[model samples]
Target: MRIIGRALAAMVLLVTAAVAGAVEEDGYELWMRYRPLDKAAQSALQPRATALVYSGTASPTAQAAISELQRGFGGMLGKVPAADTQLRNGAIVLATPASMPELAKGLEALGSEGYQLRSTVVQGKKLTVIAANSDKGLLYGAFALLRAVGTGAKLDALNTSSAPKLQLRLLNHWDNLDRTVERGYAGESIWDWWRLPDIRDRRYTDYARANASLGINGTVLNNVNSKPEILTAPWIAKAAAVADVLRPYGIKVYLSARWSTPLELKETKTADPLAPEVAEWWTRKADEIYRAIPDFGGFLVKANSEGQPGPQDYHRSHADGANMLARAVAPYKGIVMWRAFVYAHEKPVDRARQAYDEFKPLDGTFLPNVMVQVKNGAIDFQPREPFHPLFGAMPKTPLMMEFQITKEYLGFSTHMAYLGAMYEETLREDTQQKPGGFTVAQVLEDKDHGQRLTGMAGVANIGSERNWSGSHFDQANWYAYGRLAWDPQASARELAREWAAQTFTPDPRVTGPVVDMMMLSREAVVNYMTPIGLHHLMGTGHHHGPAPWVDSLGRPDWNPVYYHKADRQGVGFDRTATGSDALAQYAAPIARQYADPRTTPAKYLLWFHHLPWDYAMPSGRTLWAEMIAHYDQGVGEAKDLRARWEKLKPFIDARRHEDTANLLDVQVKEAQWWRDACIAYFQSVSGKALPQGVKAPARTLDYYKSLHFPYAPGRG
Candidate 1:
């Protein structure tokens, strides 16, 4: 019995050791995934990162840089370099002019936030210097240097400097006070509202670390469809606690202020922008907030669009409302981001035209601290949208681009629809803000906006899921948004490549195929869901799946049919002269290009004009036939994505590979559903037979219409 017991103890010890030493990776690290490299890569890197010589006592941001470099080195090379006080062989120095003046020459040109990394031979040893104007720059430089090393950039010839193209890069969370996230497909909100200033989760620091790693500087907490109570004293303390965690990472916290706060709080009878009491109440509120969080980034307002109260209620313009709040925060150097996604409650002459019409006239009337935040497209975040007409039209107003990083209309988290392509497409558009001049990206970098701030905001798609974003690939969108926000003109394909290299492996063999698939992912979604300019064809309230036939909503714009008017004569909404004439909202050149089908880009042909089923396409096929080809191609792409990822199984771990594979299986099925249901509906309306060699939908139109999701994910 004694011999058996001793043997059992030995077996238990062996099991415990095995469990402790096992190599397992859940995707919580995201693109910062710095698992140890293989023998060769680690062997090449370990000697170069032998010592980190960051002079003087480190500031919080510098300390952050030091910690990150250590983490990266330890993880990737299995070597955490010693923090040496003096320079030595292959020593990497994180420095500013005040800290190490010898290494800071030519760094003055790098600006406050910009950084430079240079490799020089000092005496006989290699010295890599990361020099900057400030501690923030040193931190950014640290990330750049590590990223290059991780991606296998040659260390010998390294010389690089980069500054943010936009002044403010922010992430907007749509988390409600109740902890439910609107349009969030991930799990519950990460912000635990129940836990106050008392219990600050370690996840808060992790969140800040992630954002700082990507050059993101601000986060707007709470939903745009906000609750009034968030502005109360208790909530202010809770927000301050979060701000405390993020401040070290150089991130300022902003809040979505419900415009009707005073009214709901009974601090005032009416929340009119022009009313003295209302203005005073807001001023006091801003002061209180600033007192708690001295570096508080200001308000994000969503008003008068979707039943949200606004200054328009008191017959004042949007500028009036924005200016009123802008005044309140401007004293503390804070700015207000007023959303331009609006229309009257009644059906508009064209819902797409409403925002442009309203804001265009009041462009110069806004306060210096107020910026109008415009969506990337005229409509909501469709699978594809012509760049929003407002991008170039409102040059007098400080216009900030708002991209949805969350896949709200693009199959939520289930489908792999990379958004890097979508972001690049809109940013690169020739906005024609000046004749023979600015692209949409250039317009954002305009220095003439005076005291008006230039910035970009992304609707954050994050949650309490262990991986942060629900799916693994959704992490790419978050990473892409941050990278592009730093430099809007940065190539999405290159970012995809870099992301794949760092997140998976620096191995080009793994990265090359991943880049190809991601580059095509967004277009694949557009093909299946809204090919040829068809938009807003998803289910009504939840927007879960196909519902092109839906037309019973109270407001015309709420119904999908209003966007795509399919009939016996033609299909697609006509924005040309004969219909809404919404094209007139664009520049004359753009209007002319889209005036006739002959000049319009084939991708957007159906969006701006309605054409008969037999109309000849540029491909020498009938419009009906071409549409079928796109839908079929989309289905093929979905299947191809699955097969391609399957081959990558040998490279990726079982956990992430399996998660993606299962989702791809669902995506392929749903892509077919989108293709079939849309084809069925279009056929019913157009009275056109399936083109020769085209497969007819497997089910009747009634079968699809009967498929309903009374309860779907998101929209909490």
Candidate 2:
């Protein structure tokens, strides 16, 4: 019996070791895995590491910090550091100033959730100190140190203190309950709603780890075009289970609320915000949600837009609807994120002016718990767009910028488009409304009494794909979103380098070329797909491939022809004062710049003004010639990206390298397709001759127009 017991113990030990070994190999663990480094890097890291000592009682957050330290140390150094209850020589101490009076004196200058990591000696002992205002801050500090080490930075004199600029950094998943994600690529919805409360997938825990590492604090699990069924008792329980897993990582879960939920789910007669009975119904629903998940983040509502029912259905304004939900969740300290992407499909007026027209008047009327969520652009997430008019228009309302991390318009995951540039471009645009420094970042980082309660949300592109997002490079966009959300002021270029180092390797041979490729990627896509401000030119419904000629769809706004209005003599939409007067929506300085085609940036020329084919461009070429050159340039760049990546074959892994190589090949082919197809169709309408050195389309305009894509991958 003793020999049998010894054999069992040996078996258990072997199994544990095997499982840990396997986890180390899986790249799915992302940056948080903290696997041990190669010999050279490990040698650089070992001298700085000695013993782990934490100064606080074991709270969940503190335990999380300890667990991360253990995991990172074990993987990076091949051994976990021994934990000491007290600080000593060659020891690493994790503590808040309040927890250690001596350390508190040193940490007096640190900000909230900020930490100071310094090499110091106390009582003839050398130590590395991780001091913060709270244990959560310490955890963040530890992660930052690990990141620095991972990127092969020198560990000596590691004095660093950091805090998130934004309080709420969230990802909004546009996933439906039926597992059909709207504009979602990669795979079906990740939320396993049917089996959730009873069965928790380990993937949920991994998702939490990835998010926590990037300082993303919240996630909205469902689509903004929400279903009322998600608010039912059974679904609430399922959400609570997800919230439970996320809670440990300091992430709160939010739900998207359907405006007519009371009417559809509860059988209420009316869903009016002004109605007492409707208000009562919402309070009850809020209570039910809080009962199941005590720390539930509040609702995200997409009201009166895109055929979704809203308070406007009952003649109530958006503020009325948002305030009603805010009142219901105010007691629980929850917030209401009301989407401002509203426009009447039936309205023939400028789509760019609609959101501003609707919400700008209601400023300051919303409750403190309510935040008006505005998309980065006034129009849909186009390949390129001017800053939304609402950024500076609503001074009294807390505007939370919504950026689509998903590749809905930018060729899904097939074309390489780095959205970090897109995000940064929109945020850094000087609204030029306020007399002094008033960037979009300033509006979002607005504070009350030195306390920043601002928010930023990105529509997630993540799914159940092996690499998380569909393509390998798509992962960088996710990383970029989190970093930017934490600090809106962060440079996309700097973050690109950091992400490349962590994701691929610290080798400049690999990272330098990759960063160069990423920097120009978004512009390359824009040039090929919708260069010079041409928008909504993709095929109807699924939005895959080029179909600038698509004029027939269910609704007028649904057709590509409704947007670009190309004809016999010219192309491009006319949004100038003489046309839709959409230019009037922006500040006078910006409006004047956009209203005149001569002054408008050549990249956004077609967006703000209609132009004749004879229009002279800054490049000493006609609009027709320059437009053709851009398309040809885009195709050339795609080919160059493929060639550059192929050259890095020796540095990158065979599987990922080959995968990216294949995707780049597809990108080149499709870029040519967009060029040939768009030029062919435009020539058919405009009757223009091809410029010198330009090749004519292989297929006729009709052939390109007749092409059908009834079964595209992400059509659901």
Candidate 3:
């Protein structure tokens, strides 16, 4: 036993050393790396920093803020600031306005959760004041300052005040308890639940640090298809340990609750929302969880969706179920995030319209503490999708936008598709509701209409991979999600530049081409996979490759044929008044715009209307010709991405550069595969010969249809 124990101790030591060593070597450190700045940047930053003085009491958050400042300063300038009670020359002071009363006067406009950073003199000493209304705000301000330093910004005359536009900026980890992540391309789940409660991994702390730096304050740690066992005593204890680690970073931990937990775990007769026993059980469970972790965020429930149990099983409304959970947690100031992604197979309506039909009626009925989380698009995370109808339809309910950061539909990290542009495109789209200008972001921010608490949630792609997110470029998606969550109006191009500069280097040559590649990456993937709003046309189950010919699934909604509706006459699902009338779900002005394919953006042409194959497009080409052109263009772009990456070989690390280069090779081949497979299948249905200059597919349509992938990753 002693020999075994010693061996384990040695293993632990070696692992710790390896992790610490990776801080310098691995790109997985993400944007948190406080590497020393260039000589010019160092000279510019050092003159403004002499000492660090934090006025607040030594709480965990305060300490973390100070530690981050020290780490950033020590690495960036080769100088660690001395922590002192009084400000000195060139000192940086961090404090909440309440902690330093005199400083409160100037920071009044920073708001309750906003932060202010200003250069000022204190008692004949020059100092940089980092002041906020709360400790969490102060910590966020510190991180912002560190980020500016890392990005080679001038700090001498800095005066910046910022706050999150959205209330709940969160990352929903689709991680199961058994360590397999749903749609996670990186690896197994990062949550080492087996060793938790007693032994916490340092990675958890770093994860919190990365999230907090981006102003993300909440995380749901489990998959939405929850397991009842997560509510057990052992799992609750494990969650508490993680909460303890994250508390300092101001990130509240949340869990996805299994709706039938009372029945599954406690041997109850029924899990009815109106039942006294079920209500009491949930209340007691909430009490138990709050007692273990004082600031437990709340629950994320995906009930009655894709086989999940819910109040509907007992002939009750969604509001009934959500209100029940809300009442249970309201006493503890916790909110319930009830998903709006519900659908029933029994319903004979369009799958895209189901969520809107179900939730629109329950708009004003939900409790204030309950938020109905809606996906960015009406359908599942497609390569491209029109903004969800619920974005503007729910005027009385607070809706949280849920975006999938994991590449479920966009080629799963193997293809470089930057989603920041996609997110921004969705948010900035004019819903055209009300008289004045109104966007999806405005719909979220319009608190007067009872859309009080706005939130943005990204399904996390992070796992235990050495590079954090499977591929080097994949890290940019995580970064982009956080930046947009903080400020939805942020430019995707600018965010890509910031990430590239910090992650790779600040060289214009390196960042310029990389950002260019990233900005167009998403469109390229869409072109190859589902251009012009074609969606869910991937291979069954795995969703890794193209299988546009798949039509034999069990249910109509489960089949790709139902979504594309490609036939001899035309292609695309008709959601306008002529078909399902799904377009009417949006506000009138926006609906009118999409009602006509001629006026609707070409990017979403097929999504809104089913057009003839030979219909004229804005590009002076027929729809079929345009489709062929897009596929050919996508293939060319993938080839260009490979060549551009080849040019960057000298600038990037050999390992990462080569890795990305090889992936681009796969991407190019797959792009051709998608083009050929889709063209062949569509041609077979339309019976149209290939347009001039568009080469015939090397393989027959039957060959593409016969392909199988039983062992594909992310198939659950």
Candidate 4:
């Protein structure tokens, strides 16, 4: 009996040791985790990935591609491939036409940044080839090869080609010099501003690798509310160090230029665009920057929005300010990204119309080097908004689409809301400006205009957190943003599937369910937070929780009450001719469609019209009851997200699975909090009883309204 007990204890100990040997991932690798594949997959890939042959010049970019392939093959197949000069069977050949003309045939059309992958025979040896026009394209091809294998593609049958539709794919970091990220829900800023240029973090290299994998070519290192000090020699040196690390990966560093830098630095008496001294100061500053970093991408200016100084303060047009800086950078072949998110201190009849009213007339006046960066929506980054009218309105001026990857208005980092659907919805929206089905994607690509400078910028959510993004799932948003930036017309659903397969196991059973969860995630947030076109109902200042009753803020548009305008009579702001005439900004077809409440899509019904509580919805329910139903439905979906994830636990490592499960718990509570508070406040105004099947608020209106978060994670 004693021997039997001892044997049982020994067996248990051996089992524990084996389980512990299987390391748990902390999500720091992101989607680039080239972990060992299953035995069958490894065996299948090993033959094709046995050797790497490069025929191009041994430049730094080519070396980077070689190193990445070795690292990926080593991890995925448990053996690094040998580098060989001679072509052989199962060799992965990388080349440009100048180096290996026969191997790179028909690859010239791919352009400098595009790549072609094929399985072909070269001199009687069947090999897989990665051919491009330049070293930058070779780097992209390397990542593509690894991505294909990591996502469970068969190597022997490889045949694909890819090119970025957009000219500039960038990540706009709102990181401050002090390391606080404005509207950033992650940890502190990843850029160690104080320690940079001398003591660079290895994480910077990883950041570049991740961005390069997604074809993102540029990064703005500071917040749009820029500091003049960034132009000083010390900060310029810091940016130069970051640029050195990213250059090999085909990325250029850009800065957010403070509009009044010359004036603030005391170099010029005024920052007026017309002033010769100010222009001279800008030219000298550009020269200094180019001296430090020769390939420096140019400036991203905020100018005249949210109290940031611009040419408007000097009684000049936006073009005047943009052209001044454009000329300064044009000498070095750099470009300027001038933002179009501007509004006045004094509120207009409709705040949404302010940007269009100011910039529409000045469309053709901007310099060729200047691209106007426009946010996806006319208003702030609401969960749901009509696509901005300026997409097609500015045909002569190049426009760059700006998307907020962080979830400031969509419940921050705690909630499990995937934003790919939101981005796709706006991209697919028809501007109806042309006769043959014009879309926002078409407007951005501008193929009709000869495919001139085009771009997409996502406000980065990266931070110093272990996972880079605040939460495990939040990393998907970053990945999706980059993929869509590379190709605006790419399907969000397909991107989500690719991300799921790479980030986790590539098994179809796991990826299918994960993609489904991501597909409906954004709509769930919309239902609970701001359903049916309602926008900006969050608490003032911090923007944390629900606060529909507070209307005492300084600016009328700053208050939540100003947006919903709820009363005993009805809810929603009227944007039609009957009210603010904001709808006139859209093309005539859309204006006509939204003129009547009956014709408008239900999702945007309240956004453009204020309907009575008793108005009949398509669902055969009153508007009041419909709103309540949406709130309840959203809460249920949040719970469903958790339940769906629970089933995935067996397939995922316990550490990441449990981390996501814990956040899902918080998300469920927050979703209920959003639902209950909104229903309670709107009910008070409507003076109506709860719908028959709906649950009443967990607490009173006073209890919900009394809550405050002065120390929220992203208060800046």
What candidate 3 gets wrong by more than 4 Å, as runs, is 1-24, 449-451
C-alpha local distance difference test of each model: 0.89, 0.85, 0.87, 0.92
Candidate 2's displacement at residue 92, Å, is: 2.9
The superposed Cα distance between candidate 4 and the true structure at residue 274, in angstroms, equals: 0.7
Clashes of each: 0, 3, 0, 0
Candidate 3 lDDT over residue span 118-213, tens digit each:
887778777788889888888999998987776666777788888888889999998998888889999888899888889999999999988988
Which should have the higher lDDT, number 1 or number 2? 1
> TM-score per candidate, in order?
0.97, 0.94, 0.95, 0.98
Task: Return the candidate ranking by TM-score, descending.
Answer: 4, 1, 3, 2
> Which numbered prediction scores highest in lDDT against the true structure?
4
Which model, 1 or 3, shows the larger TM-score?
A: 1
**Tens digit of per-residue lDDT, candidate 1, span 1-716:** 99999999999999987764454457888877777878987776666788899889998988898899999888888779889879898888887889988888787556788899888877788888889999898888888887898788867788888988788899999998888899998899989989968988888888898898789999998999988989999999999999998998889999999999999998899988999999999999999999999999999999999888998889999999999999999999999999999986475688888888888899789988888999999889999899988887777788889999999999999999999999999999996657786788977876665435788999999998998888989999999999999999999999998889888888877899888989988889888999988899999989988999999988899999999888898888899899999899888888988999989998888889999988999899999989989999999999999999999988887788899999999999999999999999999998889988888998999999999897787878
lDDT of 4 by residue, 1-716 (tens): 99999999999999887785575888999999998999999888888887999864578888889999999999998999999887988899998887787878787567789999988876777798999998899899999999999888998888999999899999999999999999998899999999999998999999999999999999999999999999999999999999999999999999999999989989899999999999999999999999999999999999898889999898999999999999999999999999999987575668889889988999899999999999999889999999998989998899999999999898888888899999999999999999977999989999977747999999999999999998888999999999999899999999998899999978998999999999989999999999988999998887888999998877888899988999999999899999998999999999999999999999999899988988899999999999999999999999999999999988988889989999999989999999999999999999988879788999999999899888887755
Candidate 2: list runs displaced more than 4 Å: 1-27, 33-35, 104-112, 447-452
lDDT of 2 by residue, 62-115 (tens): 777778877887888998888778876667778776777686455655566667
- Most accurate candidate by TM-score: 4
Ranking, lDDT, top scorer first: 4, 1, 3, 2
**For each candidate, C-alpha RMSD in Å?**
2.2, 4.9, 5.4, 1.9
Candidate 4 lDDT (Cα, whole model)?
0.92
Candidate 3 local distance difference test against the native: 0.87
Q: Tell how far residue 690 is off in model 2, in angstroms.
A: 0.8
Q: In terms of TM-score, how similar is model 4 to the real structure? A: 0.98
Question: Which run of 10 residues does model 2 get worst, by summed lDDT?
Answer: 22-31
